[model samples]
Target: MVKYLEAIRKELDYAYQVEMPQMDDWTEIDIQPVIRKLLVRIIGKMIVGNPACRSEEWLHLGEHFTEDFVAASIIMRLLPKWLHPMITNILPQRWRLRKGLQKTRDIVDPAVLRHEEANKKRARGEKVDEEDSMLNWVIDNAGKDQVLKILPEIVLVMFVPAAHTTAMAISNVLFDLCSHPEWAEKLRAEVTDVTNEFGLLGEKLPVRDWTGKLEFLDSFFQESQRMSQPISITPNRYAYEEVIFKDGLRIPKGALVGFVAVHNQIDPEIAPNPEVFDPTRCLRKRQSSPEERDKHLAGQPSKENFAFGYGSQACPGRNYAVAVLKMVLSRMLVDYEFKFKPGDSKPKKYHLMEFIIPDPTATLMMRKRK
Candidate 1:
């Protein structure tokens, strides 16, 4: 996970320093697509193997797969699985949906096949790279059932959790900065201090090292996520046994239960003045000690905040996602000055479709800070 974060940070640094420096010449072009492609490449390299997965074809396939998955999940939720075939087949978007599925299969199948071949070679006493990927790791350790079932699921897991979520979160942060110009100067100062402290400007800094020192940036990200939770209510979970709630609410065995994270995050009792964007809330808590700070932010299963879900089923990828976002944002801040277009004073609001939160539609004007 750390290595993956480092890889993403390295790519982000490269983009900011090398690629973005030249973007001024292409003022007519939109940079969000470029940012999305870079993010997908860095993330893909970590989830799948590097050389095999980093292609224009794979990136396009992944994008299509993401769109199709969102559409399918939405449609399936509204209708029964038994009726989906007929419903999807008749829809105007059905062909694109089918094509998207096929494209995903085509992209993932090769990774699966490669893993199989690698396993065969390993079984025949061949060596495999220790730093390969989750696909290779699963193939080497688990049985054939796991390889067939769990391995394929990993791709889907990463697609929804990492790709879509991270992209949207980064977009939100950018949009927030654009909307709130007052916060931008403070964030830039924080970034400047951290960069100078670590000597990161005009140099490739190790992500792990820099990420640990980004207290304010970390706070900003946590605050942003709290305000704009990617998932509204976590998925419906079946109660293992009968459970009782406050106010005489009882849940029976096999009952489907839902938890609303958005309400908790905005609960004024817990977070006073909850409607305002305050990035310092978490940072103030962190001023004491590392252990206490962690405990404070560990997120209890109360009616407070449960954006990443609650209990044992909470998001396993939260740590990784936070780290990646921090790295990307830090790199961007250190390398570029970003702001909203002129006269667009209001921050754009994000569109929410069921549980998934779409990225805010806003244009940011960025230039390298001299």
Candidate 2:
């Protein structure tokens, strides 16, 4: 994951240095769409073995799949499983999903087949490419014959999570930065200082190198997620035994236990000024011991400051996410100047649907800095 994120950061850096110069001719254009395109492309290349997945087919596949999956998942949850197919089939969503799934299968099938064949050639004393990606790694690790059977499912599982989650997270962070212009200069200062000291941005900076170094940038991302969790609610967990809480509440065995992370994130007791956007909150807490900091941040599972999930189920992809976010934002800050549209006073409101809240559409007019 770290390596893949580094690859993304490198692409972003190239865009900042090489591509931005060409934008001088266009007087006005929406930068967010372009940035989103680049990010999705970089992430697609990382998740799937092919950079071409960012082409129209897979991009359309991503959009359709997200819509259909959300609709299907919600319907299945609200109604009985038996009734779900009937309702879904009646709607246009089912057709969109079928087509999207077919496209996804088409895109991934060839890659999986290629990896399998490569592994076979390697066994027969043929040299294989060293730069082969995650799909190749998974294929090599799993016995070739066994992998050939389960490869498609494995690819699907990896693709959906990475594509949806990474794209949404990037969108949220970009929107937040655009909305809160006050933090821009400070964030830029930090990124500039760090980049000057290290020569390059991205995975080259070790986890320890900037672990807590970019404090304000880290806090800003955390606060953005706190206000707008990627997923509204996490999965439902069935309790095998009774569990007691500090507030004299006992959850009985066989009961469903779930948490509303949003509530915990904004609770007055946890955060002194819950209503205001303050990016400094997490950084201040970081100065203290790990135990104390964890206590302060702990609550019902939420993206509210919990960019990653909680305890045993926390996201393993967090380290990679942080690295990529830092690298991308740092590069953007150093290379461009962003401002809102004229007379567009109010910030764009995040759009919420079921468990997901996507970034609103807004053009961040850009000019290359001297």
Candidate 3:
């Protein structure tokens, strides 16, 4: 996926122009929907490549699948545990999911088949153009024979979560920036310095890692995440049977457990002025222990932060998520300016299930940077 960042970058530019509102003057937008469209297109291009990436039907599935899924999960959870199996079959969520899965197969299955056919041609010693995107990447790694059986499922898995979570992350960060515009200039300056040094602002677009050098931006993003983690508890585990701990702690069978993640973020022992939004926090940590630089990166989970989960089950997509986050944010900071729509400067976050999501209907005023 990292190898394809350049392609992702190009897709983002395309999506930005096509989907984002353009005006010399400030324009208020319900930015979340626009961002969803932009991310879906970019994710589509990365996952399956062109035409499918731009397909309205494919884009609609990418955008809506998770909404239905999350809503369904909430509804099911509200009902009795015994009713879940029955509800799962009859609920509108199940229908939407099945419908989306079919659309996913309809779009991705043929692409996978065509890729396999192209591979057969190459095996016959016939020249064929290389296919780019995660779909091809997965086939190469998973092998053609094994992947064909579940290619659409693989694409669906990648597309839904990637689009929803990343879009939410972007939205939360923008809302943070809007709430605290004092940090905006500092972030913009860092983006400009890094991009200019690497010639990222020009058409040539150097093939090197510029996002790595934006230390302040990285810290700022980490800080934004720290301030507004998606969930209140994490590393959720189920006790299949009764077990006693060495500390005399005991858990009954069928018990679920998780850490209170919000505590760590706000505990003054771990952070000075814990209530403050300090963009320099992670950067200073990274600097203090240069050997452990990656441990403090925006996407990496630590003893202090658990937004990405922990252990082997930690989000395998964290690296890709972090990469896209920085790249897109850098471009946004450099090319445009944004803030809350007047009188909504401090829109409060609302809860959905255990997740703390930004106000879904929030608006932001954005204009091209001069």
- TM-score of every prediction relative to native: 0.81, 0.80, 0.92
Tell me how candidate 3 scores on lDDT. 0.81
User: Can you tell me which runs of candidate 3 are displaced by over 4 Å?
Assistant: 143-149, 201-208, 240-243, 252-254, 289-295
* Tens digit of per-residue lDDT, candidate 3, span 167-225: 77888888889888999999988877766666773244433356667778778888888
lDDT of 1 by residue, 138-179 (tens): 655676565565454566567556676777777667766766
- Residue 322 of model 3, lDDT score: 75
Candidates arranged by TM-score, highest first = 3, 1, 2
Task: Please tell me which predicted candidate would have the highest lDDT against the true structure.
Answer: 3
| Candidate with more favorable, higher lDDT: 1 or 2 | 1
Q: Which is the winner by TM-score between candidate 1 and candidate 3?
A: 3
What lDDT does candidate 1 reach at residue 95? 73
User: What's the CA error at residue 190 for candidate 1, in Å?
Assistant: 3.4
Candidate 2 lDDT over 207-307, as tens digits, reads: 43553467677777777777766665454467999999999899999998655556666887777788887888777776567664543231223434444
Error of 2 at 272 (Å): 1.3
In candidate 2, how many Å is residue 181 off?
2.2
Q: How does each model score on lDDT?
A: 0.65, 0.62, 0.81
